[model samples]
Target: MTQTPDETASDAGSQLLDAALMHVPFDGWSDTAFRAAIEDTGIAPAVARGLFPRGAIDLAAAFHRRGDDAMVTALQQHDLSTMRFRDQVTLAVRLRLEAVEDKEAVRRGATLFALPMHAAEGARLVWGTADRIWTALGDTSRDINWYTKRATLSGVYSSTVLYWLGDDSLEHQATWAFLDRRIGDVMQIEKTKAQLRKAPGLSSVLKRADSLLSRVKAPKSKHSNLPGGWTVPR
Candidate 1:
């Protein structure tokens, strides 16, 4: 069987990444690690550079996305039938962290992404992870809630990861406790939102807001007409 260009590129990138991981802990996703991966994989320098144009930054992104992919696969295999929605979310986040093969690699990636030039990329990766988790957990929100849900979970996941990195408790129990508290805080906000939805004067205001936001639809995979305005009455 012949391989497509994309397939070939993907295989090359994965190979390079696998080799690069060996050096990331010491090199912190720097050019040195990328160069070493090229040498280790015996891939053509041009091809490796083509696969990762920005070098280590792209490798770091691939590493994060690979973890997300693993999390999605794990979520699909798990039985969440009896779990509360909050517990499901917590488990998804935990599964994401558990997908990592090496904590030091993550620490190095975190340091690389924390640089000013890469901060936006870091945020994008974090948001992507949150989006993946929500999608895997069967989130059907099509309104403003779609954005809000991911944004809120992004904060939770990022904070939990940072806490987990520093946590030395048995099995990172402290981090899980911290995650539960954060989720509890979010649930409390949700409770307050439900209360506001039933309030006297505030109810009307929120209703109008919800009405406007209801028209905002989630984007389809192919072509997206998101934030579509002024839907014609049926």
Candidate 2:
């Protein structure tokens, strides 16, 4: 039977994700061993290296320092010829940071990190694996709601990491909480903009304002008084 387009895409995506995760450092994996494993999985060594840019030590150090520059430098060391899906994601976050100020970079990084949660099926697997204890005790629900919950949680997790990237504060928890609040505010702003787009009078008000502003000043309609040196326009 012919596979559907979505099924084909998902299968390819899963393959890429498998290749990407072959060397997660937290699993006592060395970069050399991970590279070998990725090679064994049929992914080219160049591709694997590009996807997992930082060596275990560098990755750990960058995480400890919460340094965006370190992360970007690591990512930039790789060639794009063998770029994987996760590599694209990491690049996205890094580029976003380079494009903005530190504070805005945190926000951009958080949102950019969340993009993979929407695009990559592997994100659900990663979140589920990490939060298995919570999933085991939580009430079972429709797949949509389950996915929604997972994405929301993943978004929060991403935001926390982003906040840590630029956090100079003594307490990391406060930075994490600040990011959460900022995410909420960003969501509210998006919702408000969507609602305003749908509202009836919004376009009319904008158009009227534009029209009023568009008229010429007519040279200020110079006036001068009759005997008191003031005269009105003729």
**RMSD of each candidate relative to the true structure:** 2.2, 21.6
lDDT of 2 by residue, 165-188 (tens): 667776455664565475566467
The segments of candidate 2 whose C-alpha lies over 4 angstroms from its true place after superposition are 1-126, 129-137, 182-234
Error of 2 at 102 (Å): 22
Question: Compared with the true structure, what per-residue lDDT tens digits does model 1 show for residues 1-234?
Answer: 999999999999999999999999888899999999999999999998898999989999999999999999999999999999999999999999989999999999888888999999999899999999998888887666888898899999999999988989998899889999999999999999999899898989998888877776555552554432334446
How does each model score on lDDT?
Answer: 0.90, 0.44
Best by TM-score: 1
Q: Which candidate's lDDT is highest? A: 1
Q: How far is candidate 2 from the true structure (C-alpha RMSD, Å)?
A: 21.6
